[model samples]
Target: MHEGATLGRRFTTLRAEPHDVPGVDRWVALDARRDVEVTVDILTSLAPGAVRQAAVRAAQVRDARFARVLASGRENVGSDRVTYVVTERPHGVRASDLIHERVVPPRVAGAIVGEAARALQVAAGQGIHHGFLRARAITVADGGRVVVSGLDAEGELATQAGLGRGRTEQADAAALAHLYLALVTGMESEQVTVPDLPDALSLGAANLARAAIAGTGPDTLAQVAAAMGPPDPAALRGLRGSLPSLPAVAHEEPQEPHAPIAVSPETLAAAEHQTELSIAAAVAAPGVAAEVAAERIVAPELEPGAAVDRSLYASPEEAAQFSRRTRKAVERERDQPLALDTFEEINEEQNAGDDRSVVQATLEFAQRHLPRNAPLDAAVERAQDRAGRSGPLSTGPLLVGLFATALLIVGLVAFNMLVSPVPMDGLSTREPDYPAYTFSPAPLPSASPSATNTE
Candidate 1:
């Protein structure tokens, strides 16, 4: 299939090649429509009912550590039936990859298992078990965040469909322990040796791993989470074992040189005395005429222990001279005025000019690339002008007008309430009928009178 081809009518395949999932025919195809990277597992051979049930169960799961199922459905592709389940793509290397690369620290392993256990707990709460909770199913995201994926609806569906064995909470716990062991020893074997765990890890961490794998320790995931605390940074330093040894180099024939002559005892003793003096001088006053200090501290020949003074220098004058020199140096440093050199001033000016140039360039670039419109420009200008001349927008008159309008409404409502008639006992009484007025004939009159006169 080509990239951008629609999958299930909503997700577009981002790449042509699909990632193969181990022990399953379903290949992971990256989706383009998702905000975060997500993969859709396209299974060519899965029962429709299994797909539907898995989709429902996957949707019901809502845990941060669990890779959420975005969508799942069955679709007809050409002459074949295909089932697809889309899940959020976790953003890190696989736990198994990390395990093979280097030994995972015990504390880090504990923490990862702990996180996975929490996720398992969530799945168990929803009556869903992760049948395939292995190292490859777990991902260590950035910032050491552990994400558990591969909880495809098909696996659960398969189990329910009687094609495979069903997974339980206890089984998930055991798998988590195995995962921890694999990480600690950098091996994927069921037979775990707690003694092989790095010396850097705590005893509690080792025990936790053993308990998890053996089903002897914390039976519940919550208890496991509580037991596996955060890994110690200091302990993590010694997590990895020694590096592999290099190949041995072949030896060549040895060459003989002239024998060295022995040095006189007097010269050796004097050299040793000088070394001791130098060390003492460095310890007493570092960088303060170290060589001269060492020389001055040299022991003078004593005439039968003749009254040794408890002073570093042989005479008081020497001590006074040393103090005077130190004071002079301090005075010189204090008297010097603090000022920037010509080179420093020049550099500062150059830097300021460069900053201005950069700002101008950025502004020009933005103007060239950014879209513009006359109405938007006008609106922005108006907003800027308003902002420049700002006092708070006066709402006093508006508030007063609103208050008056509210009062009028209240008054009208009150008047209507007071004057309106209310029906009593859910019946309306009709008004009594009034007599109607009848018009009397004015007289057949004038015409009849004229007729009578004529007769």
Candidate 2:
């Protein structure tokens, strides 16, 4: 047992032996300061230098949804050699566990796929790929938060071990679709019967899943995420059905505190017997026959090769007629003004007469109020003569000069108010009144000065 063994400088105090991770053996360990838990993968079967390359590639990934890598190194203990890769331990149960237990509802499953798709999209932007995405690699945290582990490092390790088949954006989409199907049907299989999906699930979800599974849907993860839209928490909760609890694993005699316990033959037999008995009981239960019949009636056979033509035109005449109708519809839509635009046009037309009347009234008022006067006419003539002499004053310079004069006056006023202090002498000279008190004087002793002369 290497419970207290430390790996890299940051990760110290291994708390457990290598357990089952998606593509590698994972050991839970405390960080250097023991502040948080981290997982370390010992890639013993991977080709030489695989971990190093994966570490370099993973260092560039900055997506929050990815399980961040802490460090990677090569180490040898006794006759065994392995590469260690440390990553943050996300606190959640494996998505596979939930699927096996039949806890994830259809809507929740869509949401989970959507989240994984978002993470994949982020990784794709950086040219990073998760070639080994599986139910075990995905963790479903509280509040439906999905965390994808085993990014580039797992893929590299798998390739080194000759377990990697192929990796592409299309492959990832298909795998995600398969995952969604498994969650919805609670079945672990490579192929899914689209017709078996519950009618309660939306048709859009079914189409999206079918397209992804067939590799005929959106090519990129971003498009897949967009297609899934946002998951409805209320619908998920309402539609989810209760499932039976998982049977507890039988254990043998206790061993060392952190030592691994191997399942005995007796334990395996007992577990198998229990599972068989449970299945038998479920089969013999009442309504079992009726339920199976209902399922058959609800799930219809979907022919994969069946094609439905959704085109509007089937012949040349039909095509011409459809084109003409489409053209007319478009023209009508284009020519139709919006309600606001129509209202604005009508308002302008109605206000035109009122505007002219107002202007005429203003002129008449100005004429009545500002009657012609001899003195005013003389002043205007003199102003015109001065302007002519000045070679026609520029309005721009005159306005600028007025603005500058106003600014100067404002500056002087501000300076007087802020910088200068007013004298207090002329305000008031009266002193504040207070109550007065008189003290009686005591007689002084006069013998101390004469005492020195007498001595």
Candidate 3:
């Protein structure tokens, strides 16, 4: 079809090129009678009855989120018979274009997919489903509105029929999930392997995507959408204002040639007469231009205020602000003392190498690059071999480190036992001491002494 060609004597094609839908020749056309822009999907290969039925069901789905179907019928144009469905042209950036251009944050990507799901959920309620769903079929419009095009047209034109409602619904949900994944991961929907979700995605969103990929999504499309929650307004704000406007029809009309703008010589002279006179006078006078240039190059006179030392570094206000901040910081430090002088201690130890403990140094170096456990003998041999190869560094230090670790552990155990030891009587086989709670309260009586003696 060529541009300006009329279909059914109503919709006129704005452009000769058709949108890249796999099996359908979809074009952006203007509905002459309605004075509105709409998309016309011309199907010469699909079943006419199926196409009409799909369009009729799609038209029944009245949603702002969807590009509403206007009409569908068989049209005899020229030598061939074709089935066409006219739907409102969606006004926004297609998800396909947006995802390809830049990396969309997960929140924005999820929001786009969530809005599509909500629209499809509504369509599914009326027994109408978008059997063929992909990123290309969805649009992100201004104010975060998602207008889903090719709802049933895509399926009908692509021959996606005979898939039962259950299957179609599941396919749509999975396709939506794939679309979300593509937006988030910047991969195509047809990718066989599911990519890893970005760390920024919330746990709930990750789980929802994983479930859909595993073929255990929610029972209804609505449930799947609800789990994603509402679209994030903040994320959507970034995508709202960049929607592409609908293409306009190019009707060539006779254009009159624009005359060149002209200005009179007298007007030009009047505008710059004084400036011209001054320049000519300056040129006539010898050394006047040079004097003017010298005057321009000369630095301005300085004003006296604060001394160079203080003012060069900072102004009064800035100095005051800094002093106040420093005082506050000192007060805070005084109130809350630091647990350790970490940097100072480390720097001192690093600088004063002679004062450092040999055993401690060996332990630190050994711990810094400790490897997996090996036989003690093998490790000693390797250390010895390395020490021999490198003269000053010896296995003797490493040996001391191993002995120090063992001695430290033993010392700790001995300290603990000395501080809190088990009683000698506990090791005896005597009957275990009765719990204090088990003994009944002493029979309180005035004659307590006699009761005690009896006990």
Candidate 4:
């Protein structure tokens, strides 16, 4: 594996070497976002879609004996579309490696194979079969825990010569039997033919393996492991080595302090004098009140240790320093009466007068400033006169209007009578205002000639 390589664009590889799987490349990668370590199995020259689909199915199967699939996808590397599956990193030596060094007793092998078989059974119940189950697919973790890897992405095992691929319960059972044989015999072979076992091997386990190879074994691999019983604790003691020791952490060295900059004697003395001036000015003068000095000086407070005097206004000496125009403007501003003072005087006068509502006083005050327009005044006076007056002049227009309207209607009637061609007598045949059915009498029965003769 390349240094600093990543899988799924999320999990970054921390180790340069991959785990010892037969065909697939497995790296211990760190999922930085989740802050957890995971195993990323990169399958080369395989169908990315098939492996991804299998990984999805494998993820749904959860068991302590099985490594949990976390994620899977295809990532482009150079000219190749690499298919990778991420799973929880099982912390144990692979059964293939452990057996390669030395074969464990049949009982211990049974325990490990049984756990793997049970895990496969669970997966089978959910319709997911481990297509390629080899000795390397199982791991002997701490406390003799057996964890089985390789689920949907088992197609990578097919890349190894002499290993066949089968995606069914039967295939899984047969492969699991093959793994058990390899574990006990310490022989790493992927063949299905049953080999001669040592006399120490249990007859039940031997028979089960033979039947599994012959396709006549129990329906589930778990049942076959059950017949073999649990493993021996003593036999399993030396199978897994001690956990690796943690590396010593190095402490960071403390940094040296920086030296203070050196200042000359004259610069130090000037800085101290400036600080003293600032302190004195702050203590003696309180903002705007400081301007009341006898003689106005430009930035006088900035002078070191300058004394300030207490006064309400500048002295004649300071006033003389200003221009004539400035003095005139100031004098004019001081002489003018304030709006508040004028309002107080007006209020005092009102208090001395007869008691009056505020609204009435306000109206009187507003009237004094009202425009004295003769036309407007005359218009208002006329409106008041008309309001009070009760005579013919006020109603004369309405009366004249009604009389003129009557005269015009009579003139129109006379003109219409002279111009119209239809006669008044012709109106007799016109329909009445009420219903004709109700107004007209019932028609008299017309006398038939025969009835008249009988009468």
TM-score of 2: 0.48
List, residue by residue over 48-140, the lDDT tens digit for candidate 2.
Answer: 355556766876888777888888765444454455778888866567666645735566777788889888887888877887678878876
- What clash pairs does model 2 have? none
Across 134-159, the per-residue lDDT of candidate 1 in tens digits comes to 77778766556677876646456555
Candidate 1: how many backbone clashes? Answer: 0
TM-score of 1: 0.46
Residue-level error in angstroms, candidate 4, position 77: 5.7
In candidate 3, what are the lDDT values of residues 1-455, reduced to their tens digit?
Answer: 55677876889889644565554677889999989888887765424455656777788777888888887765456765566778888776778776544566777777887778888878887777887777778887766678888777677666533432332777788777777766666555445244656678776678777776676774567765766677665666547453333122233588999998795443333334334445655785567766554433222345787333322233445555655676798899887736566655565555543333454456446644763222332333344334333233357999999999999999999999899967988686778888667765677546668788998
Give candidate 4 regions above 4 Å deviation. Answer: 7-9, 16-25, 34-36, 74-82, 156-163, 188-196, 209-219, 230-238, 242-455
CA lDDT, every model vs. true structure? 0.61, 0.64, 0.66, 0.64
Native-vs-model 4 lDDT?
Answer: 0.64
TM-score for every candidate vs. truth? Answer: 0.46, 0.48, 0.48, 0.45
Evaluate model 3: give its TM-score: 0.48
Candidate 4 clashing pairs? none
Error of 3 at 29 (Å): 1.5
Report RMSD (Å) for each prediction in the order shown. Answer: 32.1, 34.0, 28.2, 37.8
